[model samples]
Target: MDIIDLGMGNPDGATPQPVVEAAIAAIQNPANHGYPPFMGTASFRHSITAWYQHRYGVALDPEGEALPLLGSKEGLTHLALAYVNPGDLVLVPSPAYPAHFRGPMIAGARIHNLILKPENDWLIDLAAIPDAVAEAAKILYFNYPSNPTAATAPRGVFPGDCRLCPQVRDSVGS
Candidate 1:
């Protein structure tokens, strides 16, 4: 019998040659053996800032704003710890990456799941959220190229379209 396995979302192929080579080179460097800086290296932060500026024509301060995390999971959790207060409401789309909800969970925030419908191209219906919930929500989480669903938000879905719901205080996009 043939069985299909689908739990982990790891890529099915080997790491690309360039990425593998870079990782190997980094590991071989004696300077990289020690524990990394808490906020990431200055060079990495600078690179990120430069990349953002180049890609989006937006300027970011490398020293103050560009933080490099080990991964999105750790970053999200830390963000939750920093921003969420106990009993605060967090709006998360359903069928989301586990970390999106887990971070808020660890922060003791109450999660209000917004169901992503196929009809809406997996986008949450912000209007469907009750006025009370929307008003009380501290954070609204969104993801493009969504895990599991692989849904991508249409252009102008954020900032432009999001302004329609003004009650939401903060939003985190992944």
Candidate 2:
């Protein structure tokens, strides 16, 4: 018998030498030893804001809008906690990363799984969702270069012509 493990998303390769070296140096710095700020150091947030501005031409306030998280899972969880309310509907892509669903679950939000079908290039078929569910949804979670499925949304499919129902207050994409 042969075994092939595919459930985990760990990288197949080692970290780049420069990146590892940089991490080691940062860890060794005396200035880096203290507990980090709750929302991350100002420098980290500023760097994130700057990257967004450079990559997407979007300006974000470092102090108010930008936050550095341990990882996307934690970020998504916090986002759910911040926006989701009990009885609120959360639209999530089916076959999504576990945290996408878990966050809303922890927030007591109703989970509305949007099926990502292969016929639609693994994108959610908005039309398939019931109008009531769509109208009640408060948050929509999407991930491009999606985990497990490895699906990529076409250009303009997100943050473009996509017209989520008016009730949607937050759309998180990673």
Off by over 4 Å in 1: 1-8, 16-22, 158-174
Backbone clashes for every candidate come to 0, 0
Question: Candidate 2 at 139: error in angstroms?
Answer: 0.9
Model 2 lDDT, residue 110, Cα: 91
In angstroms, what RMSD does candidate 1 have relative to the true structure? 4.0
Question: lDDT per residue, candidate 2, 36-136, as tens digits?
Answer: 98988898999999999988777999999987777888989889999999889999988888889898999999998888888898887777778788778
lDDT of 1 by residue, 1-174 (tens): 775433337676799999999999999999889997887889889999999988867699999998888788888888898999999999998888788889999999999999998999998787788888878988888878877588997655655345434433233231
Candidate 1 achieves a global lDDT of 0.81
Estimate candidate 2's alpha-carbon lDDT, on a 0 to 1 scale: 0.81
Instruction: Kindly provide the TM-score of model 2 when superposed on the true structure, using C-alpha atoms.
Output: 0.80
Scanning candidate 2 in windows of ten residues, the lowest lDDT window is: 165-174
